[model samples]
Target: MTEPILPRIRPEIAALAPYKQGRQAGPDAFKLSSNENPFDPLPSVVSALQSATPINRYPDAAATRLRERLASRYGVGSDQVHVASGSVAILYQLVQAVASVGDEVIYAWRSFEAYPGLPLVAGATGIPVPLTEDSRHDLDAMADAVTERTRAILVCTPNNPTGPIVTSAEFEAFVARVPADVLIILDEAYAEFVTAEDAVDGLAERVYEQHPNVVVLRTFSKAYGLAGLRVGYAIGHTAVLNAARATGIPLSVTAAAETAALASLDAEAELLQRVAVLVERRTTVIAALRAQGWDVPDSQANFVWLPTGERTDEVAAVFLDADIVVRPFSGDGIRISVGEHESVEKVLQAAQSVVERRQ
Candidate 1:
């Protein structure tokens, strides 16, 4: 076959693979693949979505109401709050805003899979600092990796896939080491699920006030069960947010998304009650896994990491056979989202099967 002529594309972007999401499960299977809230949307959120109509008109390109609401809750100006389709969208915007060709963006390895791609999209080099043996960010090592070419650093709390958080003191110390000019993004997608008192609270700690370069990215996806709607926001310096806004695709936040997010906030008390339940489930799942002799990380997020090592795929097969779909990283491990209560026993059963095989 003759080679087809192709449009000129950046070699780096051409080499990149599109983002892969967790596998969808069969109807009878429990999907613990994505770290998603197993619970259904709250009634208030549902009502808001139902009432949202006239899709004929374009959405508020600014996401004005949602930004104002988030601003009030965080005690920041609306100008400082940037709402996007999802926190990950803001991640892309922030990276594009600061880093580009020849610049470097630093983040922990085995973290949110999106981290590596964000830098690549902006024509920047990604400097991934490996996690500690315990699956936590080595803040000191990350700080040491910084160079004059470094433009941004991403910190994912309750670090994804591995499941541990950087403590407040550790973050403060890390921040002191990084130059004030470097942008630091705090990706707190799972913040609402964190139970650790010492875990860095971006909003509560007011880190942005002390460090203008800091931007906190949050989403209504996990805790609020608005994953499908894709509403996330960022709290940071107005100028920084403005830059992100300039780079973003306009009117991406649909009216339904903003309305549902607003409703989620109004029913925050009740929605948080659901989060509390998930937290309890997370606690139980972690304890059970630990008791089973698995070297599971101490996860404060809504998922637990199973370091299955070389047996990763084989172990994942075991779960699949048991009708429990899990997110498995080829040679590393599996990340099991804390899902429906009924699925717990099935998860443990499949896990026990893997343990028995090893014996």
Candidate 2:
């Protein structure tokens, strides 16, 4: 018999690799690779989850209650709020809605690990502008990269894997340069963790009011500790969000997730207290690493970026030896999440070792 021919696949899709999450750590090791909130879910969230037991039934495809709650909180009309499994799910929906084939999507290089891949899935080219020396989005360069084919732009504030935020002034000036028609996504997954006075608060600034093309993406994962539930929302004009909704899979946001998200909002004060503690831990970690001569970036998120360069793997090994797992970006650097307070000393010890090894 003749060998069967392989099914046809899109060359771009074939070339793309699946998204890899941070490595899981052994029981004895501190898993600091994923930037997850170290605290457990609040009692209210747990209680809410327990109550959402109608798993035999499909979730409300529209997620109306959660959407309404978020709408009331953000002071937007219900239509302006779109709910999804996570902020990342909303990213995919928005990209699919706006881009295809020869279109181009621009975002900062080494920002969110997901940004580059998102465009490829939409059959669009990804324009990754390099970050500045300080590991922040070079908005001027990104603005300059836009072309007639550019359909959307992703701005990951407190950029993931390299924690530095795009400031409000910089964002406003950059927005001024871009054409009015292009879609601008403010990816604020870590917004609650941000303590910097100058950091851009997309919702607070009401970006969409002035720039109808802009959408604010936020999540219950990082701050609300709802990572397992995978619920998030986007705020934008109803027309823009309706386009995204058209591309999305129905009933993607589960009832458990919606319930947990509402509970999280109810316990916002307590959850923020947890965020404050993590912020303090992050400050301590950054200070200790800098004192050890590491060129760590000023992180407003729950993680720190160490530009280990060629020694990325070597330094990561040092961390592993100390029973602390970190996310290393091959030749670029390492991203260590601010985990348990107990893990802080271990992180500093590992950093000190890497420093001594270089000497």
Candidate 3:
């Protein structure tokens, strides 16, 4: 049988590779590919999920209660909070609402793997400004990349895959340079992991309220260990969030997810203590990597960036062979998430092997 010639797919999308998530690990393998919380769910979260009522009914389409809880926690109004299936879904909504054909969404290259696709899905051009050699966002260059056709700017703090954050002072200056009309999304998916003294805390900075065009995207997937629930939120101006809301899938947040999120918030102190442990583990991993002659970046997130450069794929295979899973960006680097304590030793062992082979 002959295949149909005109699938009529958009040429740009047709040529694009589908977004690749971190590789799943086998039974005996330690999965450190995704920057996910390593801890098991809090007792409170499990209790909430088990106690969820009316599973047959549709969730509150607006996630109203969760929004109110988050707004109060973040010191914002409920109208300013937007919760969705996940932060990625929020990103699509924001992009679709703000960008269209010929419009542009600008973000740093080697940042979040998801940012590029959001614009493509929205029929907007994606302008990926290169990250600095040190694997940090070049905000000055990013600000300069903005043009009349640019509709949005995505800023990923403690940027995914690469762990460095945009400092508070740097971000404030960069925001000052961006036009107030363009949407600025501060994707802080890994915010809870950042222990740095100088990183920009978008929620704490009150940039969402101070800058009408800015929005902050956060997720329960990372620090809260609720990745399986797919609940995340955005804090923005009421009007701006409404535009995103218009583009979202209705009733995307499930009752189970809503319940888990509320419970997680109730257990915030305990969860953050786990975050502190991961922070300490990350520090040790970075130190070990450096001592092994690998020039790894200081990661504020729950992952370390290994600039394997041209040997990225080769280095990734080494870790895989060691029964360790890690995310590899071909021709660029690998992102190794901080995982179980045993996994840390395995990661360091692999790093040592890689360094020895290179030397």
**Candidate achieving the largest lDDT:** 1
Task: Summarize candidate 1's per-residue lDDT along 1-359 as a digit string, tens digits.
Answer: 99999999999889988988999999999999988889888877888888885699888999999888888988989999999999999999999999999999999998999899999999999999999999999999999999999999999998998889889999999999999999999999999999899999998998998999999989999999899989999998999999999999999999999999999999999988989999999898888888999999999999999998898999999999999999999888999999999999999999988888889
lDDT tens string, model 3, 145-245?
99999999999988888899999999999999999999999999999988889999989888887799999999999999999989999998999999999
Alpha-carbon lDDT, every model: 0.93, 0.92, 0.92
What would the TM-scores of all predictions be?
0.99, 0.98, 0.98
Question: Across residues 220-264, which tens digit of lDDT does each residue of candidate 2 receive?
Answer: 989899988899999999999999999999989999999899889
Alpha-carbon runs more than 4 Å astray in model 3 = 5-7
Higher-lDDT candidate of 1 and 2: 1
Q: What residue pairs clash in candidate 3, if any at all?
A: none
Error of 2 at 17 (Å): 1.0
